[model samples]
Target: MKNSLKLVLAVVLCVFLAGVAGFADEYILGIGFTIFMYIALAQSWVVLSGLTGYISLGHVVFFGSGAYVFILIWGLVPVWLGVFCSGIVVGLVSLIVGYPVLRVRGPYFVILSFGLAELVKNLVLINEARMYVSMRPVFGAPALYQLYTAMLLLAIIATGLTYWIRRSRFGAGLRSIREDEEAAETIGVPVAKLKLLAFAISGVIPAMVGAIFIMRSGIFQSGDAFTPIVSFTMVTMAIIGGSDDAPGPFLGVVFLVLLQELLWVNWPEVYMIILGILLLGFVLFIPNGIYGWLSEKYFGNKKNVT
Candidate 1:
């Protein structure tokens, strides 16, 4: 009952933010959109990496694929339909990729995931060059509003799904796999299937968000779509906020987005350096992240209170 109320309040808050964006200055709306976008992306990353303890350096593969797929199909269908289809396609891709890749554990899995993303990016670049693929920049108030609302919805869905998984039997299985994969399997956790399912679920939202984001931006490029920086940013957000907790990624996104905006405005040249220092400090001192630290300090155990 408490969780349900929290979810309801969150939804109401997002809707209220949307309503405010409708009347706010374009700059403010843009900031809101960026924040929501990162929240969705970070949460999606957390779904698999946080829950299953598989760090994927190439999760941007789905994001880029969705953006490209949306561009490919947008002209033939409604924009909304195109975005949905893009997510389905990306989720299917994750299932196929996860089957073989999930067999490898630890750093090898992370490296393979990164390789796959690079491969996808190269393929996209080659295709764009060969076919002269290009998109005209989209603009206007209506497009912005649509993008903002879609992003907000994606964030909400991702957060709700994380909350559900954290409390479900399936979530417990994933947590076990994270702690000890072989032990999980020995205990009949069906590690392989659960990991793949989690991976697929993690893929879908980011893909949908990518499609919506590209549509809003009005232009798409292979480089931007497949950038490893995005994947890194999501991972950083999840880690910095507390990857073990459902609310960690969201909190991390909120802090990072605001920090980024401030840095970009005042110290763009040194922002990356500052970010690196902060990340290093977190790794050395608060490895479990802010959420984990706070939970330990106040509640003793996040699972109990959450």
Candidate 2:
């Protein structure tokens, strides 16, 4: 009951924000769109990494692939259909890659994932150069509004899925794998399958977000599409928000997006340094993240006592 109420309230708040953005100036709507994009990415990261405790440094592989695919195919179909197809393509790719990569564990898995993104980026660069591929510009307020709505819906779906998973048997299996894969396997959890499923689920939304991003920006380049910074940003948001809880990534997105808009805009030169300082502070003082800390301080102790 309480969980449902929280979800309802969250959805209402998101809708209210969207309504405000619809009437506000273009700048405000742009900011809202960016926030929604980050939220979608962060929630997607939380789906696999947070629940399964598998840190992927190359998740942007899916994102870039989706963007490139959308750019290649959008002219042949409706933009929305193109974005959906891009997600499907990424999901299939995840399944193909997950089988082999998911077999590895620990730093090996992280390194392999990171390496995959770099490999993909290079391949994209080479392919684009060889084919002379370029995306045509997109314009108009209607397109921007479409991008905004797509992002908002994607963010809601990603977070809602995370919440559902957190309370389901599948979520429990993932949690078990996170705690100890060997033990989970011994206890009859299908660790491999669960991980792959989680990976596929996690990949799809980010890919869709990538498609929306490229559509809105009206351009795509391998360097920009496969930027390692995006991977880091998503991971940081999930970690800083509370990887163990569904609401953590949302909180992280809100806090960091606001911080970026307010402070990074003013001191763009030292933005990364500022972000590093904030991350370090969180790691040192509140390692479990803001949500985790709040949960522990307020609800955890009370539950224990009762």
Candidate 3:
């Protein structure tokens, strides 16, 4: 489909979903919230990893760190303010660390990203132990509808950011760097600057996503907060959605999350097995993912993000 039509559909869908949040039962609302949360996370990943071809295997570090930051100051401030602060803190830290980390390329950078997340997780774990802090149930979180609304807003922000960036000169430069860093730099692209900026941009929303997610769960554990599966799911959604443009992550997240929900309900014993099969099927048959495949079928290699 054309970008214009896709944008229209997205806006309509967002409006419809927003309208439903007010009347949907708690279970359905929770599902919608999870979907929006993943949408935000996936689009945020696309800002850096998808556009720049710098696949991040440890994106959950920001998520977990954001959760930790918010948990530490949970009752000390307004919840929304705490979520905002988490994003700000994570963004700044990523900017500082991204400078040196962005120097690596290829598989090495991937390994570094994964290792960095693990290191942060262990440090948090050790710190928690030292403080003798046991996991405590969260109390007095904001209303469910309030969190759902906030998360929906975040999803919109992340989706719009990716969409805008994908067609802008900056996004073009990032894609160029993705294709060939040395060649992009030879042509005057500020490779380091764009990568760092994208890296920082990618970190912010997920941090907020993590903060809100913890509030939803009403308890925090370092292990669950920093789990690698979060990273895996984000990457998988982007890949499955064909992170070539604005609508891809939304499609990917909805499909996977809904599929998982159904499978878990009916085939709990083999839900993961079915998911693995689906992932593998996408990898083998629909390599470009659902959006990419659709574009190819309808546009015949005609679609371009720019």
Per-candidate TM-score against the hidden true structure = 0.94, 0.94, 0.95
Q: Across residues 22-119, which tens digit of lDDT does each residue of candidate 2 receive?
A: 66777877888888888888888877888888889998988999998887886788778989999999999889989998988888888998999999
**Model 3 lDDT per residue over 53-109, tens place:** 898999999899899988988899888899999999999999999999999998998
Clashing pairs in 3: none
Candidate 2: list runs displaced more than 4 Å: 134-142, 301-306
User: How far does residue 159 in candidate 1 sit from its true spot (Å)?
Assistant: 0.6
lDDT of each: 0.85, 0.85, 0.90
Candidate 2 has its poorest 10 consecutive residues by lDDT at 134-143
Off by over 4 Å in 1: 1-5, 134-142, 302-306
> If the candidates were sorted by their lDDT against the true structure, best first, what order would they fall in?
3, 1, 2
TM-score, candidate number 3:
0.95
Better of 1 and 3 by lDDT: 3
Task: Please give the RMSD of candidate 2 to the true structure.
Answer: 2.3
